[model samples]
Target: MKRRPRRSVPATLTAVVLLAACAFVAVAAIQPIVGETPWVSYRSVADALHGARWTDLVPAIAGGVAALLGLVLLLTAILPGKLTVLPLLGELDSGASRRSYRSTLRAAVSTVDGVSAAKVKLKRRKVSVKVTTGRTSTGGLADAVRGALERRLDQIVPAVRPAVKVKVHAVRSAS
Candidate 1:
């Protein structure tokens, strides 16, 4: 399934507040405007700047808040995310979650003939695969799993394909 990007919590909250403010203004002014006496005046950004003073307590607090907000935005933009959202076919973002991508990878690895089973783990920038197969086929099977997943990843997440690592182990049997 394709995933749609979600606006963050802050963004959603901002939208809600703006919508409420607009609605309140419209309701409050509707009667006055209909009676030919407009009741509200809008503040411009320039007005705020004109009133701002460095020594003023309110403006100083407001400026500090603005600076903190900017810092948060900068950090989030500069740092890499734990797991990247993969772009889907013809879509900007996938509707599926990271776990879905892991499952898809697990399926791809299991398709190999000798791979008895497969486990997939997704890390910050890597995908690790552990497969179980006979001792004699360990090396080749591990290589095959890695190769197959690498190709599948190209289709699943074309952007920033995480490094794929595969390991094989023989299942123990009680003698």
Candidate 2:
């Protein structure tokens, strides 16, 4: 089974929070109509809004939050999904996941001469590989890894083309 990509964070959180708020609004609206109910904390909304200074401040803060939430939701809805995978050439149906991309990059770096281990992190515009190189010549590992990655990327053209950066940390010889 194929898993769907997740929606934006603010959109998901805002939807859940707004649904909870609706329940509160429903109870608040019906409180005044429910005669002789102990839950009737206020005589009317006017009294609730007119009294304490905190009441006005609370609503103002809530309004600000609500406005920001609304703006984010609109933007997320209008914007296209951020694609992290590269598609197979001439085959739109076949694509690679970002996780697999990072894994392959790590494998590529680890295979390079003098590289004892490697860790790769994929960002929007850059692929960062941190490697522990053994007590051997390490001048060309970075270039080798970068070349391999570029070749891999050329093979599978992703939506975003990120530059590669390799950081080689020398492993200390244990006495």
Put down candidate 1 lDDT per residue, 1-175, tens digits, no spaces.
3343443755666678789999977876685667755454444545877888889999889889989977886675565555345545545544446778888999999899888888899875688988987556355787788889988977765555578888887785434
lDDT for model 2, please: 0.72
Per-candidate clashes come to 3, 0
lDDT tens string, model 2, 41-119?
6566668777758547787898898899788788777765645555444544666777887787777666667778888
46 in model 1: Cα distance from truth in Å?
Answer: 51
Find the candidate with the highest lDDT and give its number.
1
Which candidate achieves the best TM-score against the true structure? 2
**What value of lDDT does candidate 1 attain over all alpha carbons?**
0.73
Off by over 4 Å in 2: 1-5, 27-37, 50-59, 91-93, 154-161, 173-175
RMSD of each: 8.9, 4.5
Q: After TM-score superposition, what is the CA distance of residue 47 in candidate 2 from its true location, in Å?
A: 0.3
